[model samples]
Each structure stands twice: as C-alpha cells, then as structure tokens.
Target: MYISGIGIVFTRGRGIDSFEKALKEGWREPSRTGLIPAYRVGPETLTDASLSKKIRRADRFSRMAVLSAVDAYGNSGITVNEREKLGIILATAFGPHTTTFSFLDDILDYGDANVSPTKFSNSVHNAAASYVSAILESRGPTVTLTQFKLAFQNALILAGSWIAEGRCDHVLCGCADELGMVMECACKMKLNIAKDGKINPFAFSDSPVSVPGEGSVFVMLSKEKGSNNYGKVGEISFSQNITRKPDLFVIDTDGMSAYETGYKDIINYDTVIAGYSPVFGSMLTGSAFNFAAAALMLKNQIAYKCIFQDNPFGAKLCVETSAKNLNEIYCIKICRPEIKTIVRLQK
Candidate 1:
C-alpha cells in the first residue's frame, strides 16, 4: 500500500516542512526537571475550537492521537463519507501514562470508590484508539497495541494486512506516546543521560546517551495510488538475520546497548546510513518518527544532514555523491539481542 499522506508532530513542530527545518537546525528542548532532554509536543497545538465537544473531554494522549489522525485524513483528501471505510490503528510503548498515574493517585489518596471515573476511563491502553475512532466517527476496526520498542512497527504490519485483506480501503495508522514524571524517572535510572544535556547520535560516548522523547505521527495508507502519495509501504518482516541490505538504513539507536547491538552489522555498512534519534531524541515509539523522516526524505529526494556523524555531516545528495534512485528504506526495531520487526519502505 502507498502512503497517501503523513501528519507528524514532534519536538520541532507539525507537518513535513517544520520537520525538515528542525532536522536541519537540530533543535531540542531541555526538560524542566534537569533530567535527560525530551522532545515534547505542546498541548496548545490543538485549540478548543478545533476539536468537538466530546473530543475535548479526552485525555492528553487521546488528544494528540485525534489531532494527528485529523491531519492525516485532511492531507489524504478523503471525504467524510469515506471515513466509514477507514480503520484506526495506534501503537505506543506507554499509553497515557500521565492519566494512568493520576488515576492511581486518586485511588491511593482517596479510595477506589471515590476515585475519578473519568481518569479511570482514559487509563486503558485502548482509550486513545477509541477516542480516535469516536472523533472521526469511523465505524471500521479500531485497534491499539503496546510492544515496548517494536509497537509502531507491529502496528504497521497490521495496518498493511488489513488493507491487503480488503478489510478497509484506507487505514489511519499512528504511533503516539506521552511521557510522565514516573516515566522520566524510570528513564533516568535506566539509560545514561548526557552531562551536557544534548543528544549526539554518532558521538563516541563511553556511556549510553538515551534521552526521553514523546510525540505522535499518523499516516494515511491506501491500496490505490493518489496525488498525495509520499511512497509505497513495501515489505514488513521480523527476522533474526537481515541478509540483504537496503538502499538506506534507519537505525533505532537510543543509546541502549541491547537495541544498538542488533544493528551492529548494518551500522558500519558501506551503503547510506542515517540516524535521526539525536534530532528527535529517544522514546519507545521514536522509530515511528524515524520512519516518517525517512519517507519524507525519500519523497523529496534529499537526505538531511546527520549533525553528529563524523565523515559526512552536511552533504547534500547529488549524482556524484549518492545513488540516483533511493528505492528501499529499512526501519529495524530491536529490543535486545533479538530483532523484533523490520518495516521496509519503497519509493
């Protein structure tokens, strides 16, 4: 299936233009708690007037997901009536942690009987996906999955299957995650935070430089080609040995040794190797953003400069510099020594 449209929101901003500019500038915001830096999507991006009355009641995670799906649908140029044929699939490492923790706080402070019912409603992993379907009025299948680092990749596999099986004409597939105080603390305890509070993906650090980040990205995928098609969603697989290398490699290196080890062989390959984790920061669903960036680059026929890499930092693509057709892009997801999922994109 081809990617009809894309709506991405990260630390930089929304849409393709903002993401490309931020990629070139390498902008990131420091956390207030003085922990690792995080790429957070602000709450003010969606105003009260933009959302419906029912959608306004949703929690932050659902709000982000809804807005992203809205943007994806808008960009796809599909009619409102066609939405009934659209399915909503969302993937997240941590779904609405802020709301879940608040519900827990209410139960701990008061009691289960006196806890906030609204908080409890939005605490489940499927709450955000439900809100997306409700806001879009989509009667098609709505599913949510949580698989730590490989959540987004797995979601893509399911979305592709649904389209192939004639289950839905188009699927609004997305990956959304929201960071909370508890999650932030867990990151600090788990990975190494850069002392300078900056992410350098290619830097030779003695310790892992994993920064926490959160955002949402939704893409419209259809079996038929459209004018807004960015690229085609090709092969999606999960294998231990990746024998064939792709034209471009989007490695998910969050400074975690386990994730990094899975890509060691391909990391030093002669083909084009691009890492954007430093630009968007690191999160469980950060691979979603990486896939978006890679698709954008493939569509634009331009590769953004990897600021941290040693040899080629700001080299623009030319016939003399790189290949003519950047056909395949491999997005590899690794949890530890095991390779969980590999999503292949073709232009």
Candidate 2:
C-alpha cells in the first residue's frame, strides 16, 4: 500500500512543517521532568476553543487522536465522500491514561453510584477511535488495538491485510500515546534518565534513558498510488530475515538500552543509519512517529541529522551526507523483550 498523506503531532510541534523544521534544527529545547528529558505535545495545541468546539468536552486522548486523524485526512486531500470508504485502525499503548485515572479517582471519592458518567464513558481504550470515527463521520471499519510496544506494527499488519482483501479503498492507520503524571512517575521509579536532560542513542550508557514522550501520528494509505503519495509500504513482516539491503535505514533507537542491542547487531556496517528519538523523546508508540519521519525523508530526498551521536565507522549519518538516490528504506521497530518487526517502504 502507498502512503497518500501523513499527519504528526509531537513535542517538536504539529504538521509536516514543524516536523521537518525540528529534524533540521535538532533537539536544542526539550522539557525536563526531574532530571530526565521529556517531550510533550502541548495540550493547548489542541485546546483551541473555536477549532475544537465540538470535541471540547472530549478527553485529551480523544482530542489528540481526532486532530491527528483529521490532519492526515485533510493532507491526503481525500474528500468527504472518499473518506466514507476509508477504514480506521488506531493503535495505542497507553490509551486515555489521564481519563482512566480520573474515573478511578471519581469512583474512590464518590463511590460507583456517584462517579462521573462522562469520565467513565471516556475511560475505555476504544474511546479515542470511536471519537475519531464520529468526528470524521466514517462508516467503514474502525478498530482499536493495544499490544504494548508493538501496537502500531500489529495495526499495520492488520491494515495491509484489510487492503489486500479489498475491505476498504483506503485506511487511516497510526498510533497515539498521551503523557500522564502517573505514567511518568512509574517510568521514573522503574527506569533511569540522563542527568543532562539529553538522550544519547549511539553511545552505551550505564543508566538507561527514561524520558517519556507522547504524541499521535496518522497516515492515509491506499492500495493504489496517488499524485500526493509519499511512498509505497510493502511487506510488513514479524520474521527477522532480510535478503536485500535498503538504501536507507531508520532504526528505533529510543535511548533505551534493551531495544538498541538487537538493532545494532542486525544493521549493516555500510548502511546509512538514521535516528530521531532525540527530537520526539522515548515512547512505546514511538515507531509511528519514526514511520512518519521515514516517509517525509523519502518524499523530501533529504535525510535529517541524527542528533547527539556521530556517524558510524562505515555508515553515513544523515546530517553530514545526503540521501540523494534513496529508493528503498527499512524501518525497524523493537517491541521490548523479543519482538522485532521490520517494515519495508519504497519510493
């Protein structure tokens, strides 16, 4: 399937303009949590009273998911009629944590009988996808999935199958995560963060980088290529074997030491390696943002620099060298303990 359009909202900013700008500039400014460097898509970014009049009462997760999907749909230039034929696949690791906890608080404070009904309704994992469907008025299949770190990858696999079976003309697929105080506290307790508030992906550190980030990314994909198509997504596999070397390599090195080892062992010495976690911070659903970055790089013919790390011995870092003849790109997503999913994209 071909990616017709992409929408991203992250700690850097919103839209393609902000995404590209952040890549070019690198990470000079990032929010700090205690000593850890954190990335966040400001709640104010989606809280415009005039723009979000309809979803003003919706929780942050619903607002973020709806806005990201709407942005992708608008960028795809897919009309309302066309959108009716578009299916939605939303993958999330931590869905509506803020609202979920709020409901829990209500239940504890007022008991089940007096708990807030609105919070209770929005606490489910599928609420974001439901809100997206309602806001978009999409009649096609809308599915929400959650599988820890591999949520987005699993969603992509399902979406590709749906398109192959002629289930829908197009599919809006992506992953989203919202930052919550409870999650951050858990990360701080379980993981280690850099003292300088910066993440170094290349170097080996004794302490793992525990910075938590949150955002949403949506891509409009179809079986046929369009005038605005960024690139073609072909053959998403959970199996780890690869026969051909890609022109560019995008690795999900999110400053977590555990996920970095397997990628380091697999990547070729001469292949060009690109990393973007410094700009977006580390999150379970970060691969969704990484996939968006790969599409942008293929479309623009310019590879953004890998911040905080030098180029490998035989490989060229995107910042110093140009990716001029990029035709195929490989994106590796490592979903903790043993799961590794590889996605192949071509121009």
Candidate 3:
C-alpha cells in the first residue's frame, strides 16, 4: 500500500504555517520541548458530536488520537464510506496514560472492588482505536499494537501488509502517546537530570536521560493512487539480532547499517525522513514520532536533518539532506538491541 496522505498533531512548536515561517526564518529557535506540541485543527475534526463535552470525559491520549485523526482525514480529502472496506491500526507506548494512573489511584484509594467502570473501559489499549472507528462510522477491522518503542513502526507494517493482502482498501494508521505523573516519576528515577530538569539526547552529560513529550500522528494508506494528496510508501523491513548496544545504536550509527542490511539490498531512495528525536525522548513510542515526522516531510516535500549522539559503543552521526529527485525514495530504519529493521517509503 502507498501512503496517500498524512496529518500530524504535535506540541505547539510548528504546524504547516509555523513550519513555513520557521523555514523562512532559518529555523533559528525551533521548538525542542518533548511535551505534546501544539497543533491547529478545525471544529469538525472530531466525528463525535459530544466530543467537546467528552474531552473532559476522555483521557488525554484518546483526545490526541481523535483530534489527530480528524486532521489527517481532512487533509487527505477522502471521505469515508461506511460500507467501504476500511481498517485502522492504532499504536501507543503508554496506553491510556492518564487513565492508567487514575485507575491506579482509584485502586490505591478504594481498592479493586470500587474501581469505576468508566475508567476501566477507557483505560484499555484499544480505546482510542475504538473511538476512531465509532466516530468514522467504520465497521471495518481495527487493531492496536504496542511494541514499546516500535509501536508505530509495527502498526505501519501491519497496515501495509493488510493493504497488500487486499484485506482493506484503506487503512488509517496512527500512533499516540501522552505524558503523566508516573512517567515523570520514572524519568526522575531513571535519567540523570540537569539542574533545570532537561535531558538532551545529544549531550552525553551526566544526564543521559531524554526529555518527555507526546503527540499523535496519522496517515492514510491505499493500494491504488489517484488525484489525491499522496506520498509513496516505499518499503518496510525488520532485522532481529541487531548485536548493538541500545544507547550506542542511536548515537553512533547513522542508521546506515540497518538501511544497508534491510532496504539497501532491495531498493535505493534519495531522501530519508528520520523519526529519531521524538522517539529519543522516551524510547517508548519514539518510532511513532519519527514515522509521523518523516511522513510529514515527504508530504510537504521538505528535507530534514537527523541528529544522533556519540556513545561508548560507537561514534554518533546526524544526517541532514533533502529530497534531490522527484522519484527520491525514503527509508525508515528501526533497531533494538536484539533486532534491526528498515522500512522504505517512496516519493
């Protein structure tokens, strides 16, 4: 399947308008906070008429997914037919973060017997996917994936395979993550924070910790391409037994090794959109952030720079370039200590 269109709802740093403005301004002070970036969307972004009221009723992660899906579908300009074969593959590293914590609190305060059904229902990993299906009035297949940092990549792979298999005409694939007190506490315990409580991934300073942030991104995938806004979905690959240290993997390698092993042998692409930074923050749903960012770059015809840091295992590398040719292909490389993989998306 090909990636037809993409939509992103990130922390308030840069939307299409702000991104253009920053481009003209030379990207001097780009937003770097890992928190959920701000985004722009229409009032009709959500299909649920009660979404506005439900905003307070739902978890933050669910809200992000709902808002992002609306923006994505709007940008695609493809209306969903209830009877058409459609599917959804949603992913998240931390599912129902706020609700998870709230549920914990409830269990702590009132014990398991008094936990609210509302919270329990909303806390499921697939809640956001269910909401999206309901809002779109889609009765097609819906699946949720959770693979720690590989959640988004896994979802994309599934969506692509489903389309390739003729199981669905369209697949709405997305990844969403949110911050919560539990995450903050974990960061404090795990990372070596600076005086200001910021952790720079590039900096090997005493703090090897990454900052925390969250957002939701969506893409529409289809097998046949027409006059719609579309981006080429080149290829996806995965490798097990990476034989690389996790920290060194991100900083030392330009991600070239994974590309060479997985995608380079099959196809050659000109540009690569890196989704490393956003994923770097939590290392949980980092792939989602990178995938979404890369998709946006392909959709907007923009080049991007991917920065990696140095580690004891290897030398760090950052890639900075743009699409050089119209047929310029883009590849996404994902790796764990045990597995290394690559996915290719064409222009």
- Candidate 3 lDDT over 79-184, as tens digits, reads 6674347788888877887797798899999998999998988999898888777777767789988766457768887887887787888888888776666675
lDDT of each: 0.74, 0.78, 0.55
Q: Where does candidate 2 clash, by residue pair? A: none
Report the poorest 10 consecutive residues by lDDT, candidate 2.
Answer: 310-319
Task: Give all TM-scores, in the order shown.
Answer: 0.90, 0.93, 0.73
Greater-TM-score candidate between 1 and 2: 2
- Stretches off by above 4 angstroms in model 2 are 33-36, 48-51, 80-84, 204-207, 310-315, 321-323, 335-338
lDDT per residue (tens digit) for residues 68-122 in model 1: 7878878888664776678989999888889989998998999878999888888
RMSD of each: 3.2, 2.2, 6.8
* 1-347 per-residue lDDT for model 2 (tens digits): 99988888888667877888888888766686433457877766776554477686688788778878888887888664765567999999889989989998988898889988788888888888888787788888899998776787888888888888888778999888988888877777676765566776654333446467888999988878877788999888885666778877887777644656566545455677787888888887888888988899888887777887743433456655355777888888765445778899898
| Candidates sorted on TM-score, descending | 2, 1, 3
Provide the lowest-lDDT 10-residue window in model 1. Answer: 314-323
On TM-score, the leading prediction is 2
